[model samples]
Target: MYSYKERSHIFNTLNSYAFDVLVIGGGITGAGIALDAASRGLSVALVEMQDFAAGTSSRSTKLVHGGLRYLKQFEVGLVADVGREREIVYENAVHVTKPEWMLLPIYKEGSLGSVTTSVALRLYDRLANVRKDERRKMLSKKETLDKVPFLKTEGLKGAGYYVEYKTDDARLTMEVIKKAVEYKAVCINYARVTDFVYKKKKIVAATVKDEISGDTITIHAHQIVNATGAWIEDVQALDQAQKKKQLRLTKGIHIVIDQSVLPLEQAVYFDTEDERMVFAIPRDGKTYVGTTDTFFEDDPINPTATSEDVEYLIEAINFIFPEQNVVAQHVESTWAGVRPLIYEDGKNPSEISRKDEIWTSKSGLMTIAGGKLTGYRKMAEEIVDKIVKKNRFKHATNCITQVLALSGAKGLNSKNFEDYIKNKAKVGESLGFSYEDAKALTAKYGTNVDDVFIHAKNHSADLNLPLALYAELSYSIEKEMAYTPSDFFIRRTGMLYFDIATVEQYKSAVVDLMSNTIGYSDTEKLIYQTQLDLFIDDAKNPK
Candidate 1:
């Protein structure tokens, strides 16, 4: 597998090979395409402008489900398709994704009534092909309050409950990319495509510039795929392809608070006064509430949560969980993500369908746009199959990603993960990690826990880092290709969202470690530190 230190070798391999498919993006969609293509005996190379998952993939509501809200939009077909995909995502990456039973609290003047909510949930369960044990159920007012004590009781009729999977969206994307690498896909980050290398107006390769080294290389490939999520237009301009269809970006933000501040017992999806649904899901030792859908026209790469977005989320939380008394001060961290939904006529931001589309330009640059996280696998499969069928590439292997476990989920299934976690936690404890820390590490790394445990136990004393901290940092560097402190804090471990205090506590040591490990000069160290500081600032104190 490619490590962070193997940048030169990876670059050499990318430049030297004539790739069958060149993927231009490192988010989930691009990662999925790389994995699927490589697993089927295709030479694949992928490039990302920033760190992997630095864009919208890391900043999300972090749930994998068929869009239950789409039911309200009368997108029943989309709901059913992605509903089935939810299981495929969970089964493939069981460690990062887990079932979260969500409480849909019904109010008198809310978007859904009691009977209507129950009927909708039941239909949803059937359409999603939910297992019998995970089917929907109607809860009484008492049951609803019992599940979520902080929920407001006034105007509460009843609630419809269903299952949704919660996940670390960034980790999921990283793991997919790692699996792609394990299948021999040459992938590099901080490598941005500056221009297209065309042969007689047909895109034959791309000129990718290494953002870190300021060196450009031409990556020759028979086929090129543009899977840049929000920056779709930016890539399309390279090929000068624009037709009737276009991309409309919408921003969604989530705020994280320590669980001690407002302890939530259940994950609740409730309706705001404007009839838009928001989710308050609890994870680790934090409670996160999010996702406002409003049209946005700003820099897509680094979208920040505005005061208005934070205030709206807080107001929605207060409306649902009034007793919790959540305020702006209670917010610990925040993240804003933009959705690249395809432009639709006569549809508002919330009403835009999240179905993905594939367009092949006259220059043979295939572009995929407007998909949700849950449907990444199928979207990749569709694009690859189209390329294969159109004589762009020669491959006959069927899609086997349905059964391929992600990097950290080898030899595990949903039913046995708890036991696997317990068994691994003991091993971690024997290696001097506390029970809690051991369990957390085992859960994070899954089958890859042994390397982390060894690194944790054998960490250098010169660094003055904790056992778990050193382990995660070293494992991230040697195994996960984490190039910067922001990559470690934000995406690799998700400390920015769930444990902002940890990031604040260890930022200095982490920067020093990265500087020493990657042999960064003082100038490079300062630049990386500044980047991390800005991310911390954005998460802690939004605009």
Candidate 2:
């Protein structure tokens, strides 16, 4: 396990060593590429401007399955390939990713009827190579009602149940980074690449700036892989002469609401008024409802959910449930992410492919864009294979990520996680937490829960808040690359989405926790509080 000091040392070491490969962007794809390259005995370095998964990677609907909506569009190959890869991802990260039953409600006038949905589920099951225990099932109206009583019964039709996996997207990305570090890859967040280092017209290195301390350095590498999600075009635009037209950006928005307000026991997948499918997945004692797909014109990195987006989701949920209509108040938090799809002419954004494309520039810069989360590993393998073949480097071995366990994912079965928490609590009484908190933390961090617990135990005297703990916040700063308050609240622990009130109530605690770590003076803390207050006000009254 690498500590904070050790991670700092590793970052310093990367600056000194001329790396074999340098990866820009700490999203899942970049992390995956770094792991794939390093596990093959190549020196690697990964840098990110913000925290890992701060972009589209963290703001997803958190599903790790073949996209069922693609089936409607007849994207057979893409759907099948993603389905096949999901099995591998689930196996590799069993702790954070697990099988989930998805219920697709069939409405009378919906785009997909019961019979079509059943056939689709069957095909999905076959393509995914689902185990017998995790096969798809067709349910009658009464049976569906038994599973989800809140579902609008006016549809008067059956439903289809299919197996998929759900995961904490941010935690999964962090684990990928941790695994890459364990494989000896130098990974640093808060480090932004400002420009490419060109040696006589061929890209050779990159000038990076540390976002925290304003330190700048140039790191040399044999090859540079740009895996920045929505920022790919920005990076490619650096070399205006060699720019190739690729990457279409699509905006996706999701809203989080309390599960008790909706009270659906099973995950629901249904068509909305616009004929697009939306998911209501139950996660961490709350339900995530979202994902409106549309073209966005603003900045991709910092997307805010509009009133129109929230209205779309609220209307969709109300249309489905009818009896228990959800409103804006039901929404605790909202987030938006951009999909970096490959640009194709005359195709709708939704119709554009989710398949990844790797483009090598004339200057020998490789850029990967346009892929779903489920296919990240396979995408990484493909890109690395291309790099190795292009460089004529001796292939030491085949891709081992299939059988390789991610960091802290070893010996993790569903049954032992609770026991793992109990054992940790025994080491110090202050480490004791509610079953929900313990389970959530363990699922998010895997074996890293001990690090947070140890920090909490050491600072028990100063930090004893039930909702927010200083130790957990410090652990996030030290281990999880949490720099901003939003990183800690939104991605690190999911407090922003799970419980908005909890976040508001513990505002001071959060500020206090991060004050010393980030050197936020009293005036800066007040400014942060004002910003958060304005944000809450906007959420309450969106123009």
Candidate 3:
């Protein structure tokens, strides 16, 4: 029932029933809360102003890493908590998360020397309770160069080798929300909460506007949670619950280049000349590197990579991989997102703590702000635990999400996923898919690839589109509730960023297919088309 066609029923359900919880945000945090609350037998509803994971949740560095650098900031607890949860997250969503060995190359003049990095990683391993097989390793300079031959060798001392989990952030949020829906949580995107309805200074309902239809409705709920990340203050002001402490937004950008340009075979987490850490990781024949953390005061809705940001990352790439001689032209695409850090006086954007804080307004609107992607489940558990203990919302149930497999992950574990995908690929090959394409689809969708293969089998011959694209679009529209071209290209398929050529090659066909399938009006089709064009242009040509 979690589809584009089911939105009317979702809205009706929201309006007719007084839910135990109404979560106003649909990023990973809100999705986590929805899943937690719903799994605990609470009737839950969630609303989002944009497509799911359209904000910071989608535009992360795409690592479920234990913040090793935070050890420098003395954030030991945060490091331990999010660090240990990495394996749990990997176990729960084996399809979206994978363990990547990260190399931290140490230089003569670098802030961290071999000894210090070794100590830090050891502390990190103990704190995170890393498994014996995946613990930290100290590599000699020769070994390190063998691992990543392109590294700068003039001042190289050694490197710290450790494990980090890579993830598709947007898909992770989607799977979490889909799992919540399976537990009967009514969630809708493109529904913006305009105002809160208060009775005797207690929030009882919210005035929400359907962004697509320009229609309004009031949803009744016993408890309302404000999980809007960067826009927390905006919603707080709407509730007239703006607090003294607020969000300090920071912008981070990443640049993607073909692997041929940089040819980085190993993932490197290295320090720039300015001593700030950056990551260069290879994915599907393209190596993506990023993330410049700087204060941003403009609109957080659509953060764009400035020329300065691109140049900074390019310089970092060249500084480490000097043989590559990478430049701006090598950049295929870029993405920028804002961090909704809780405001801290006199701290730089990077220095601000990543800890999450929960606050309740005078009208009882609970808001959560400032957390990492890896800590979402724990954050949700804490929030739900508070709600249950504080108000006795319903029959309290213990958190079961620790062992819960997300959508597409059922009956699959990290140990068995390789074999599962191999076996499933043969089945997909029998259904008009190439061996390689079948393997890729099986890997991406896990057990849910069965459903996607059905879509391919049923419609690929008739669609005049790539079988993979057709199947993905069909699955996204019917199961993932992708309503717009941007939702499909940017968040759902990630073609806009990782595989931009695929987007450019198939944009018109995709738009036409979506229009005919969903019956978009001519005006809506033009708007959606223009929106996708802007995204494509922005990815190619940064601000």
Candidate 4:
């Protein structure tokens, strides 16, 4: 029922009516909170400064598992909590959240030994309530090498195979927003909360400015939840009644490379020279190896991956798999995100706890911070529970998101995904495309593939990439909130990381599709093209 006109209508009505809850920050946490509160029959309005998941949500290492490394830190509660939640998340978005096997390569002098890793995997499986399908297995050196031929055998002892889930973090965040919309929540991206509206020294509402259209408006709410992740401190500063503490920001960077370059059947988890863990995850026909954790005090909005960070990842990857020797040239794209860990005296970034803490000011402005992706739903439930208790709402029900199916998640099963693609391709053949192209398109769009076919029929015929028909681009703009080519390529279709050359080659055609579908003018299209080019340049020569 949500459309472009409906979105505009809700935006206009936000200021007119006092909402039951106004959630700030449109990251996964904010989106989850909105969906949770709205599904409980509470009127909700959620606002974001940029696009949905434009912040830390999209910049994650893109894993949805219990922190395997946390076991090293002896954070048993945190690991168990995340493990239990991972199952709930996987069930909710079966298509986007699939089980992936992670191999922890045990070197002779590595931080963790084969015996220790085997025991830990057993403990993890028990704690996570891991089903038979996702049980862990221990592998000998020969078995490990057979699974991952790239692994260096010089210092290998064995490997621990454990279950983990991978996800499109951006798409998952957006799907949460879509579900919130279905539950009748008013959600608007590109809207910034400037100042808190106060009534007799108590926070009552917020003054917001639309970043895109430059329009200002005021939205009234009984309670405001600031779930801005790294920016929580900044939002909290607006409340003079509360004490402001500096948040510890840690930069985590990931480098993408073609899977064929270092093809591994499973994700590789290995210990770096510094004793910290690093992951090489296979994703979308590419491999994402990363995440160097370093303290950062720079701009959190646009944190850039330094050359040193990339070098560190390359060194760690090459150290684990000497045969591959992954160098700078092997990297296709690199991205960095800031983790807003609560500052603790004399503690390093790696030692910081991943547990979330909720803070409420005397004026009743609630802020939630310092959680990972797996616990977002739990965080949302706790936030809403506090709101109901604070407001003394008598009719609020207990959280139901535990069983709620996100949009497009209903009737989803892994067994039928292939069949669904074939059916979509058969339909796509009617719209001037080969079976191969149709298969590709259907795999990307799922049940929504029909929308793309309709778009191709209505739009111009000479579309670039017969596989990427006009309909898919139009569907992205109209339904997925894809305002720019980067939004489509980077997040929507995942072409930015998967096939960088294809994105560059079809830039003009994509711009034309955006213009025709989203009502972008020629001047606006040119501007978007320039922005995309600069983004590509930045990806090439990351700051």
Candidate 5:
């Protein structure tokens, strides 16, 4: 309900208030910080240069599980904390996060032997406080192939079965920001912080320009936090802070192929010949595999999957699943994301740890860098606690987000999401959605589906678009603050990655609706149109 529609009164309120906290990024880190600070009774203001999650947040591998591979690096505590948080994240956002059993097939020459995987998983379960029934189990060679029939049978001693959480990364960020807004936090998209506003050489506020309207405003705050992922150094340059610590950027690319091409039934995490690990998981009628960790020396904002990147992943997929002869031509879509990790000497991208660190500049600006998606909440809690102690704030309360559900997850939990959807989908069917569509929408939006249902009903007659498409588009415009066609197609609905055809089918109609809804100038309309076209081309060609 905390809509960020263009020209909304939220902007006026943001320009007028000096909040307790001002977050400079709208990625998952900033979104989590906003929710934690606001829920702790602090007034918070957050601004993003692009749509929320447009950076590393949306382009991640989309898993919320503990970095089990970190065990190789002896990062035991990180594994324990993140592993435990996996359940917490899933419980709070059941609609967007769910448990998937992952199969780890052991080969004779692989990095993980049968005994090592079992012992490691057992340690992981105990440290993660896994429920009794969900503990890791050792599957024999026969049992492993039974679960994953396509796994390379040669030298496959056995497999380890364990639970991991799958999620929609962008939707998870959006829902978290929405919940923060519910707690009275003010957030706006497409607003870039051009400079810092300092008094007596201490940072006090920021100079922000609306990326859409081209109007500028100065936002004052008691404390400022920098959570800009990948671009943290850019914000640090604004602060003129030099430190011994720095961020090392690496690029990871993923490719999506239809099930008819890969047909991966089980989520497999296998090692490549070079000792690098990759995941091939099935989602939304497609089997998407990826993540090549190579040093990147390009723009962090829009990292593209080069032909070499595509070739490396294609080789990995074919190596593990010898039966599926997938090639670059079979790739339906691709996405590239950059990870900003703390600089570690002599360590390659994959060798670096995923742990996060918070550093305070002399100007009182706090910058956080080098964290994984699964550890966002804890990272926020740590940063906010530092702010409270340094500022001597009193209105703050304890962290309530551990138990507090996100926007649509309120009044629902992992145990009841299925039943809630079963009952609520009938309501969507009544509003002209087919039963399957109703169930699908209800599953994606959780309790918020009811609001979308209401919006769809109001637009039943006049729209020339599909009813399902209309409901989603209308809801995104009016309720989600999506002002551009790219926002609607890419972040709001995730059609760009999961279902690119739908985006291609509805691009013109969606663009026209948004242009009219937002009152875009003819020139602005062309810009938005070109933006959508660029995104479509990038999704397919990747560069």
Candidate 6:
């Protein structure tokens, strides 16, 4: 359905149709809106300046968490809403999201005492409507150390363990957009909205620039919503609609270390000296710890970890796990993401609330800004609800996304995902793949693994790549619209961060394969090669 080869066709479709709703931005929020509006039978078109989830969505902490820290800020309502949405998101995309039990170590001199933490977690469970099996548990100091032996022994009290949902953020965005495509929503990345056309002081159409083809086209739409995360102000400026409540951009960076260096078995959420919280999570064969929150005023695109940000996280890791003696050299790779919080006077970056607000301009340009990844579905529902009520569309139905299964998740739920993956792996083994590799593939692609297997069986030998890697790369290009090497390495497969060795060894081969497959011109091939090398360098050295 969605393919890089069909981008030109999609652009032509965008130009010819008069859409009912146009969403600007291809991040999680825009993807969610497209899915919602299209499922409701409204003609929808979405355009993104870069690849889908290339911004904050790809560089997140990779969790659909309920924001347990918000409880400290007394934002109970916000926590409750997002916490409940976590189940809905996980149920809809079982492959991309999983329940990860988080350990919150208690300290004698820490801000949260055992008694207070117990009360807070109990309240959190009640507010989130947590499942009985996944409820919180109080672990004794010995048991806590058994779970994480490297934690500091000086101020050890105990731990409160609870469940948090870990997600593949970029993959989740791709699946949502693919599902939107199933509903006939026309969405394209690498398309920028240059300027808007208005009649009678109401926003009606927009002139868009295709980043790849060097062509400009105008798309007519009745209503347009701006959902770009950190670039919200930039879009607002294009419309000359600067309001009082603005966005305060904050940068957060995460550093990854090989499991050989950290050897962390369990995920730990610990307190730092400055009273800030940091998470050390183990995924695949690496342990990643983050993130340092500080004010940012630079470009949001390709934001890299600074020396100070890297040092801050290193210090926090050394403080919590003092025995590890983790130095800057141990950091394998790093990523930095920018958060667009509502500007609050006299508040620090970490102190800003993570609440969302919807603003409609005089020209009827609606904008939604400042929400968490956990609440994207609900946020989309709220925006579409407003649009339907304002337009008085009698045919539009209420939100059904709460029960909708995303692409690759049909007939699969949390209760049966384990069995589904196990059975799917057998099919891969029959197709001449190792069970371990097959199982990993099934977990990553869900029901779509069959397509990947077919690609591997047909083309792996000719492509000169590993069976699994070739399958994934081919599937991404043909089915997921992955155009560049960075799109595949960084977002599609996450090998850039988790397994840098694979990226370094196969970079040139991948470029050659893509150049041949997609017919990249010489100039385009050189540019893409340089861009991917820079990203790999940035991940290793930071900036």
Which has the better lDDT: candidate 2, or candidate 6? 6
lDDT of 2 by residue, 1-543 (tens): 444445456567767978889999999999999999999888899999877898888888888989988888888888888898887887778767887899988889889887888898888888777778888899999999999887888865989888889987887888888899888888888788898878778898888888766788888898899999999888888763465756788888888877778877689888887888899988867788888888777788667788888999999999888888788877878877899988889988788888888888888889999899999899999998887775445754568998777876777655576577566545434456655665656656667777766666546545545632565687887776666677777677667766778778776777776776677778767776676666555444444
Q: Write the per-residue lDDT of candidate 5 for residues 1-543, one digit (tens) a residue.
A: 555454557777788988999999999999999999999999999999999999999899999999889998899999998998999999999999999999989999999998899899999998899888788999999999998788889999999999999999999999999999899999999889999988888898999998877889989998999999888888888885434367899999999999999988889999999999899999999988889998887888778788889999999998988898988889988889999999889999999999999988888889899888999999999999988875457869888888989988889987889999988888888778988888989899998898888777666445568887888888887778888888888788888888998888878888877777778999999999998898889889954
Residue pairs with backbone atoms closer than 3 Å in model 4 (clashes): none
**lDDT values, one for every candidate:** 0.89, 0.80, 0.92, 0.83, 0.88, 0.92
- Candidates in order, TM-scores: namely 0.98, 0.93, 0.99, 0.95, 0.98, 0.99
Candidate 4: tens digits of C-alpha lDDT, residues 1-543: 444435566678898999889999999999999999999989999998877887888888888989978888899988888899998998787656778889988888898887898888888888888888778888999999998887888889889998899988887887789889888898887789999988988899999997766788999999999999889888998886775556899999988888778786689888998999998988767889878888998778877777889999999888888888788988888888899888888988999988898888888898888989999999899999998885546667789999987766666566777787788788788777778888877665555667667766556456654545456677767776667887777666666656777778888888876776567767778888998887676566776
Q: How accurate is candidate 3 locally (lDDT)?
A: 0.92
Instruction: For model 5, name the residue pairs that clash.
Output: none
lDDT of 2 at 484: 65
Worst 10 residues of 5 by lDDT: 1-10
For residues 1-543, write the lDDT of model 6, one tens digit per residue: 688899999999999989999999999999999999999988999999999999999988999999999999999999999999999999999999999999999999999999999999999999999999989999999999999998899989999999999999999999999999999999999999999898987778989999999899999998899999999888888785444358899999999998898999899999999999999999998999998899999999889998789999999999999999999999989999999999999999888999899989988889999999999999999999999886546678888899999999999998899999899899999998889999999999899889988878566465667888888998999999999999999889989988998999989989998999999999999999999999999999976
- Kindly give the stretch of ten consecutive residues in candidate 1 with the minimal lDDT sum: 238-247
Superposed Cα deviation of residue 331, candidate 5 (Å): 0.6
Clashes per candidate, residues 3 or more apart or on different chains: 0, 0, 0, 0, 0, 0
- Candidate 6: which stretches are off by over 4 Å? 240-244, 460-462
Candidate 4 lDDT (Cα, whole model)?
A: 0.83
lDDT of 1: 0.89
Candidate 4's displacement at residue 275, Å, is 1.3
Model 4 lDDT at residue 240: 66
Which regions of candidate 4 deviate over 4 angstroms? 1-7, 243-245, 414-418, 429-445, 463-469, 521-526
